[model samples]
Target: MLIDVAIEKVKGLISFFEGYRETGFLEALQIAKEIALEMNIDATFRKRRKIKRKKQFDENPDDTNIAPQSAQESFRVNYFIRVVDQAISSLTRRFEQYEGYQKIFGFLFTSETLRSLDKDSLKSSCVNLEASLTKDKQSDIDANELFVELKSLQNFMPKENIGPVEILNFLKRHDCFPNASIAYRVLLTIPVTVALAERSFSKLKLLKSYMRTTMTQQRLNDLATIALESEVLEKIDYEDIIEDFISKNTARMRMFK
Candidate 1:
């Protein structure tokens, strides 16, 4: 789906480039890179094949003897390469999009409400996003204004660049200015990733040598979820969340507990 959209974007820009030389060339190149990166072509195929082959070999010692473990090592290397390629591509696309958005949308989010950003500032936000994804917590940087700005732009024209005060006024008159408050609330509001807890348990291995890798997968999962969600989860009753989830996913109470 993302690929299709990117392809269309490229196609759309093809003719539009006639009037724009360097700028168009650069933007089009970027779009092409993003489209290529977002295309996770090998994930499904490689994962399935790896699982299937492992299962088949497990079921038949004779078959495993035929291929040798060396062949499996080759597969592992190839899978690793694909993973690295995908990660690099993903990072490139993210940084590009963050930069692109800043070029197009930063005007709407200047001042302390949003940090005054240069190109480096946009790059800094991307770094923060990556650290947050990997560490699963907010980075020290001020990104709330930028985040709120992105959310607000969801409905606005991407190609347009209006002033910051104009945007604030639009939101204020329309009762969206209070988003500033909401954005502040979300800085540490949710468990967007499990990496934080994962890192913590990984630290546990340091203190307990016998349990270096002894933690079961299920136990690890539970630990990570609890660590990340503990603060917010403790504050709110589960019943309310269950009710909200049920309300969103079902039409009637009979479908929920």
Candidate 2:
């Protein structure tokens, strides 16, 4: 059910995180909760099981290591919840801190460096450091709009954080070509999260569509390779290579001369 819910809400979930980095933890947890709900995993079930186990332990406290087992289980459950909650909280705080620093200084640092400095760095750096990092000083362009656009990016994504087109449009809205260009530059670095590449490869697996029956695994691999490398096959006698293999195997009854 959670997977179904996730599938249905995938678009919305992505959009939220796209605009706001802080939404990452929340989205991850939401997805996890949705999955757990779908799988019918509940606190009630865990609690009931815990109670039953506790009774068994109470009846034979001397014989079994029930205390340690219970402690470990409780620790595991609490650890899971804490880890999820901490991640969400950290994301929110980190994004805000980054935004604050950028607003005052104009540059976003790498996480390592960002973690080192305090508010002192903000005063020392220019107000447009982040926006100007991507700009040519000779251009003498207004940097305010770029900062405005950056700040407007929120944690709540409408659906699918943002698409290429929407991000392009967001850049256009700010009229900060330098920042927009940089955004696109960063965008290209991210691999497409969609499974289009995998699906295309899957099509290669079905290359034996010409045959009706199930193909032998080896034959399937050969067919897939041939189909994928069809252009290269045009320049080589691939069939002859396989025929040679058959000849080598079939005509191998040699006697000592």
Candidate 3:
């Protein structure tokens, strides 16, 4: 997906989540309560029924004070709020990281973003990217080389605005601009959302249990990839897989036959 589309999607999800948490959840909870009442079950949370004692003069009142809250209100505050807040926090962190990527690769992401940059700003962005990619005296692309390549590229760009995918395509067809091509390829690799990655992690938790702590990194990665991409696995013909396996394992194939 395009960066702009990804940004919009992230914003939309955040807004929808916040709206649901603020109002929609409570509305749904009220319906649930009604249903519970109809079934003759307790709708509200169990009371704490705390036994209070007189405070000593040595203790500060603020240290021991607990605000009296209704059972339902207490449940919402202690349980629901904490759960939703964790989700919101994770979203906020991912959004912030995405924004940082946009800042570094923003100009290269689209023709509009690229065109808006002047010579100096464009050079500055390239330098920032070069620094980010640099580690232990190694770098992916030279900032000076990239800036020069982009300037040449701008002259050949079409009147219609285009995104990184199109720019990569053009570079591939021409087979020129080595630095610019590298930059675009790296930009395209950035994830639009963390959903798929996080989902894989959830699968990974189940696959790599405490009992299986001895799994190698490569093996674990392979297992996780297979688990997450099960739909692709389902689409494959079993006959073709059997044939591939047979070809690879000649001794086993002869024994089976």
Task: Give candidate 2's TM-score.
Answer: 0.22
lDDT of each: 0.48, 0.47, 0.85
Give TM-scores for every candidate, taking all chains together and pairing residue i with residue i: 0.21, 0.22, 0.67
lDDT score, residue 239, model 2?
Answer: 75
lDDT of 3 by residue, 1-257 (tens): 86667777877878877887787667878998999999999897678878788889999878787677887787778878778778888877777878888888888878877878899998999999999889999999999999998888887888689889998999998877898998899889877867878997799899999999999999999998889889998998999888888889879789778
Q: Please identify model 3 stretches exceeding 4 Å from their true place.
A: 16-25, 34-42, 48-67, 194-257
Candidate 1 residue lDDT tens string, 32-94: 557766994332212223343445534766655674344434543565445545655654554
Angstrom error at residue 20, model 3: 4.8
Clashes of each: 0, 17, 0
Question: Which segments of candidate 2 are over 4 A away from where they belong?
Answer: 1-73, 76-78, 97-257
Task: Put down candidate 2 lDDT per residue, 1-257, tens digits, no spaces.
Answer: 11222223544544454444433444555677688899988623233344443446347556655353454346435764566456556555544544453353323222223233454453243234444445554423234544343444322123343444455555566654565345444434333333645754776647656663677879877877777667798999777876666666645424211
The best-first sequence of candidates by TM-score reads: 3, 2, 1
Error of 1 at 103 (Å): 1.5
RMSD of each: 22.6, 18.5, 6.4
